[model samples]
Target chain A: MRSRSAWTIFWRTVLGRAYPRIIGAQREKSWVFFEIFLPLLQVTAYVYIYRAIEAPPEFIGFVVLGGAMSAYWLNVLWSMASQLYWEKETGNLELYIVAPTSRMAILLGMALGGMFATTLRAIAVITIGMLLFHVSMTVRNVPVLLGVFLTTLVALYGLGMLLSSLFLLFGREAWHLSNLLQEPVSLVSGFYFPVRALGQVVAAAASILPITLGLDAMRQLLFPAMLGDLRFLPAEVELGILAGLAVLFLILARRALAYFETLARREGRLSIRGQ
Target chain B: MRANGSRSEALRSLRVAAWLGWQIESNWADPFVFAIYSLVKPLAGALILVFMYAVIAKGGLQSPLFPGVFVGNALFIYVPAVLAGISWTIIDDREHYGMLKYVYTAPVNVLTYLVGRGVAKTMVATIAVVMMLLLGTLALGVPIRFGGIDWPLVLGSAMLAFFGILLGGVTLVTARHNYGVGEAVAGGLYLLCGVVFPLDTLPSWLSSIGRAIPITYWVEAMRRALLGERTALFSGLSNGALVAILAGSTVVLAVLAVLVFRLAERRARAKGLLDMQMMY
Candidate 1:
């Protein structure tokens, strides 16, 4: 009966962790500074691009929205994941692991901290984008944009928590995996210009990543009139794809966590050395 | 013996340094793993840039200034990736099982000890830089030709080395435990310095801020060095004066590094961080 209660508690702990991963709510204001820097350079990049090209007003809005959304998701998954893995490798995980709280709570604390940091960066870059590029974001697009952002955030962080578990299971293999996440997704997500900008294969791969799907859908909503070419892909298509990948990632994440816990109990620690 | 003793002691420190810095010991990963870590980011980063460029280029952003992503990346885009590569070295000393505390307690001069460690870390990082450059030139086709450099390139190389030392010193002192902040600063500096666009490409106020960083100086120097585009602003300065000033700045930087070393030593000693090193 006591063991049943403990298992029930772990499930509850995970649901608690989901609040931030899903709702995008962490302690506000205190983390506003970190967001300032991430967007600072990105907006500068966009303004530089805008001046070089006389794209339609709509296109500039597309750049601002796409860049902001993608940067947030990319930082959450890429930078945050590796930072977590490094903390684990340096034996920082021992502290969190030994904490009287649940594993879900620890993952929530670190990942939420990272997500918040990245979000801070994303918001700063968006402000810069708006000021520099003269982006005109409309109220109509905000609801859909928020929807895509929140859902993708859940998917990406879920992937992150899962990836974090892998380090616990496999150790050093986690580092190698971290490198593979961001750059490839950056290409795929079409952060700089358009999906048509990448090769067909690269574009296809980017379309598969949740961040890319979310950004593409958000782009379509922002530019609702141009449904013809689907250069950025359609909204429902992107939402469906993003939602699908997020679920697939979560299920696989749970499986990976189970294997990792078992492997760690048997092996003592994850290997930091690459073989 | 006394007459020769002074001269021998000078030579002996050299010998001691040579012995200490040259070895690959239990802490060999301090250099080796970090070197491997440093090289991977740029190779991956360059490809990511190529992807971003491909996207923007296709999106009809192409113009004369379009090289901002492709050509400008050689100066700007690669810095962040390279920073991520050197990620592990920030706390390499502290992470070693009590080795930092042991290092702090040693009778050897703190300057000598850190210099030895720096020499080791720098050697590995330098090798990693070379490998990334080669990968950029040969494998990735990044137009960062060492041979194509002219007068401007000469000044640019000095500036890059200057920035490298500054960053290395910062790592030794600040954010040693949290390298991500330093890495972000390095990457952000590259973007702000207008390596992709002219400093005029950013907001007027921000571009002025970017000007103070050595990045714009080096980026212009690199372009003039490699591409041989002699802008009037750059060509107006006497090459000899620029060289002299840059050289002087570098010497001052080395002095600053020594000060950072002293600070690191004091911190390690005060905090009992040197209790972990074991020697035969």
Candidate 2:
């Protein structure tokens, strides 16, 4: 057999890893109901809560946008962060380790696949929510919105890659940790409101999570008239922060995956199940 | 003699299953981490509502409506936790742990075992509920009166467990690969049951659907018991009438749960699905 270059192998591994998530997503019909419709229902509930409170119409837009971005955060937590632990439990981690490819490539593939799948759900949420609630937005800057949005995904998935390694190291605690992160992250991230409403200090701390800045930035751009004063920072600064986060997380994730691979080899934890 | 022997066996299974459920849930982390784990999610969940109210309501947490909404959201945790606990047991044992076939072959009653598992989740959720109530009263001034609590209505509301078992029975026959069934139902009920908002907030057609669901009444009853105020939608009914309706609804749910479980058990056995693993 002809030898493949490291670059060739890495690219191929990424493609192979992502294939299942991208294609298999379409194969499963239940995901639409579970992922899209159910989340839409939750968004609807929040919308009703805002209505019940007699909040401004823009608040409904906030809930709709928050509900949309939440799909990505969930994908990061469950499908990306806890994935390697799941793979370990299901006895697939050993195969990936034994294979002669970069572990980061496998993770990148998972990230790409998860991003694609979750985007479909997120878009569905935003579209349906807009139609149902008549949420109006003023997207003044398309390029900036896309830039911040993409950077946010990069940083968020990078964080997921890092957590995947940490989660595998921690074993069963990862499941509880993942659960712990969900609602708390949503709260701190100001998923259904402006992060500014959480006050400056708390919002500053929550910026560690990429979605916090991402959601804040997107909302600022989309709902300038209502959310202009409520933004935690100027959208420009948030974009810069997101870019820095993207780079920092990718570097950290690379190092963590290397350390994890060494530890797993020495400890022989890859084959351990039900931990 | 046979009936007595079977009853004792079922009781034993239930007792053991509850212990096992608690162990599986809490033993993954040390006591400290587990305590933090239990505290954070529910508190954060409550905080989400608090922040939402703060942003919109002029009076912030002091809004007259805050207490009921806070209490309602706090109690709503049980719907998802218990429902997921019971239904996910089927998925966990069958799919994740691959022990469902062995469990089925044993002398255990699956329905009783599921109820036992749900008991552990109820305990966890009760802690969250109590913590939320304390935080509401002390920190947020939610106006809960310990003396005014209707103990009978509160106790009667425990019949909500039957709904979890009913959903679990549906899961036993239907779910092969999906894990979100419990959460999906819970999310829908969160909207329908007026967990955070009143039923009147929903459109009349949707509110009618909410009225039909046992959980809407369950939330309203809990609010009445804990907050000493009846939901305007149900204000027409007196406390006794509310309790009677809850009891009647619970009886219907319990009977339906048993029948559903029996039918699901027969179907699962016929389809050879008890041991089936999708490996997704």
Candidate 3:
């Protein structure tokens, strides 16, 4: 057989890894009901809560947008970060380790697949939430909104890629850690409201998460009139921060993946299930 | 004599299952990490509601409605804890641990075992509820009077186990191919049960759906016990009436749970699903 170039192998590995998620997304019917419909129920609860308090109409917009972006964060946490831990439990980690392809390519494939799947759900959430709650948005800059959204996904999934290695190293703690991160990250990232309401210092600390700034910037652009004073930073600065976060997380993820590969090779424990 | 012997055997199974469940849940982390894990998740959950209220309530924490919302949200830790706890045990044992077949062939009553398994989560959630309530009263001024709390109503609300077992029974049948059943049911209940907002705030149709759910009354009863106030949704009902309704609904739910679990167990055995593994 002819030897494939490294570039060809890398692309194939990416495509190969992503295939299951993209295809499973279509094959699985339950995820749609659970991911899309049930999440809408959660978003609806928040919308009703805002209505109960008689918060401004724009606050409803905030909840809907937060609900939309949260889909990606959840995808990052469960599908991307904790995925290798799950793979280990299912006895697939050893195969990936032995495969003659870059581990990063495998993760990248998972990220691409997860992003595709989550984007569908996120769009569904936003559309349904808007129609149901009548949430109005100004959308001052479409290019900027798309940029922030895409950058947030990149940085968020990059963080996921890094956490995947650490989580695999930690074994069962990965499950509890993922669960612990869920609500806390949502709270810190200001998923259901403007991050500014969390105060400057806390919001500044939370900026380590790409979703925090991304959501803030998107809200600023989407609800500029109402959130003029509520934004944590100017959209331009948040965009720059998100850009920086995207690059930083990707680099850190690569280093961590390398370290994880080295440690797994030395210790020979990464493939062990139920550690 | 026979009935007493059977009852004791079931109790033994339940007790052992509870111990095993606790070991599985806690042994993954050391005492310190486990403590932090227990503390942070629930606090963060409560803080989400707190911050949500803060972002909107012009009166801040001083809003008259804050206590009920805070108490309701705090107590709601039980729904996911118990519901998902029981259901996830089925998935954990069958898929992750690959021990469900052995468990089935054992002398333990699977139903009792499942209920026992949920006790660990209930205990953890109880701690979280107490912590959140303390945080609410001390730090947030939620106005919960320990002396004024109705202990009976609070205890009665523990009948939520019936609902969890009911969901677990459904999970037993569906979890072969569906892993999200527990969370989906819990999330749907979060919306329908008026955890953070009154059912009245939901559309009339959805509010009617909420009213039909026993958890709506359970949450309301819990809030009443904790806060000494009735949400508008159940304001017309007296305290005794609320208890009667909760007790009645709980009995019906318990019966349904047992029946469904028996049916599911029989079906799983007949269909060769008891040992089926999907690698999900």
TM-score of 1: 0.73
Query: Which parts of model 1 are misplaced by more than 4 Å?
Result: A1-8, A15-32, A49-67, A78-121, A139-143, A223-230, A270-275, B1-40, B47-72, B75-90, B95-98, B106-148, B155-180, B231-242, B256-280
Candidate 3 lDDT (Cα, 0 to 1): 0.85
Question: TM-score for model 2?
Answer: 0.98
lDDT of 2 by residue, B163-268 (tens): 7787777777776556788888888999998889888999999989998998887788888888899877788988888788888888888898788888888898
Query: What C-alpha lDDT values do all the predictions have?
Result: 0.55, 0.87, 0.85
Candidate 3 lDDT over residue span A158-202, tens digit each: 899988877768688877888888889889999888888889999
Choose the strongest candidate by DockQ. Answer: 2
I-RMSD for candidate 2: 1.1
Q: In order, what DockQ does each candidate have? A: 0.24, 0.80, 0.76
Model 3 docking category: medium
TM-scores, all candidates, are 0.73, 0.98, 0.97
How would you encode candidate 2's per-residue C-alpha lDDT over A179-253 as one tens digit per residue? 889899989999888889889999999999999999999988998754557889988899999999999999999
Q: Which prediction has the highest lDDT against the true structure?
A: 2
Better of 1 and 2 by DockQ: 2
Q: In candidate 3, which residue ranges exceed 4 Å CA deviation? A: A1-4
